[model samples]
Target: MTLLGDLLADLDAEAAELRSVVAGLDADTWATPTPAPGWSIATQVAHLAWTDERAALAAAARTPAGREAWDAEVARALTDPASYVDDGAHELARLDPTELLAHWDAARAALGEALCAHPSSERMPWYGPPMTPASMATARLMETWAHGLDVHDALGARPAPTDRIRHVAHLGVRTRDHAFTVRGETPPAEPFRVQLEGPSGAMWTWGPADAAQRVSGPAYDFCLLSTQRAHRDDTALVATGPDAQRWLEIAQAFAGPPGPGREPAGCADARSPHG
Candidate 1:
């Protein structure tokens, strides 16, 4: 299989994992608040659905009319960058739970088809920088895992960490510069070693082994940190240098404004899920 095919397969499996958990949810359960402030389980799913649709549109913009539609989306996003995403999520979350799930199912399916049909050499336009199809698929997988973690937390499910997170882990490493750039800081001039222990007892690593700056930790914790799903203090990550230490405090794989990371696990208000 091509790299895009491999990534799409991984993305489908990741999305399915989250879907299985929510498939039988009651309306009230769907409305359950997640750790993200003011976002419900349904909202999380809606965001995913909306994003998939947008990504599909990007993939399909090969003609003049289609490119106009894509350009319009970019204009709209730039109009009120702060509220564009939240508004989409809020609008979609208003649907009946069944309808919402159906929409997400349809959207993700369309995304897969569109991406597969897209020319691999052409970049997919995005809220962030343009990305190759494989890069886009990796981003989708990362978000699915991250938002799924939010839902899992809301439901009190302690899912076992898996190798699927390797995609997210890789993004986390690749986005070290992005993490700094989003904060208006320059990325370090030198490479940093990242050595993570994945669930399958394999070490997933990146960067030069001899680099003085390094981050060493379990892959699971690093994913949570990268997504801002868990507070840095709550993770088992150890940073060897100041630059590496700062990266952990602001690591974010997703594109957008910086997120207000979760409170430390030991905080009084964090005693329960979604607290």
Candidate 2:
């Protein structure tokens, strides 16, 4: 399989993992709140479905009869960057668990088809900068995993970590510049080396071997931190230089503004033993 094909498969696997948990939930359980403020498991799934729908729209816009919807998304994102996403999630969350799950399943399938049918050389429009097919697939996977964590936490369920998070860890390393850029700060000219041990204890490394600034630790911890699902204090990942340390402090794999990261232990719930 091609890189995009592999990424798409992993994306589907990640979604399936989340679906396995949510599928068993009754309507009342779907209403159970997650860690994210004002979002339930239903809301999380709703957000995923909406995002997937937009992803498909963006892909389809590369062809005829699709540009209008994609243009509207761009307009909404420009006019109300923050509230639009929350509003979509809130509105979709009103659906029953069954309907929401079915919607998510359908949306994701449509996203896959659109991505495959679209021209590979052409970048797709999005709320943020355009994305290549692989990046889009990885972003979707990263989101599915991150939101799955919220559902897991709400249900007190512990799902085992998998090597599929390498996509997220890769995005984390790739977005080091975007991290600083979002804060209106300049990204360092020199790259930082990152070495993470995967779920099965295999090491994954990126950047130059001799880079002065570096981050090293369990891929699980790095993934959590990159997604802003865990605070630096909560992760055992080590940063070797000021730049590397600062990157961990502000790392964000998803697009948009810097996120309000999880608070350290004592300030809030630890959401412990996530690895």
Maximum-lDDT candidate: 1
Tell me the lDDT of model 1 at 104.
97
- Ten contiguous residues with the weakest lDDT in model 1: 266-275
| TM-score, predicted candidate 2 vs. hidden true structure | 0.95
lDDT scores in order: 0.89, 0.88
Q: lDDT, candidate 2, residue 55?
A: 91
Tens digits of per-residue lDDT, candidate 1, 40-108, equal 999999999999999999987888887899999999999998789889998999999889989999999
In model 1, which regions exceed 4 Å deviation?
Answer: 268-275
Clashes per model (N, Cα, C within 3 A) = 0, 0
Expressed as tens digits, the lDDT of each residue in 14-132 for candidate 2 is 99989989999899999998888778889989999988988998998965678987887788777877588888888999998889989999999999999898777778888778988
In model 2, pairs of residues that clash are none
Instruction: Let me know the TM-score candidate 1 reaches against the reference structure.
Output: 0.95
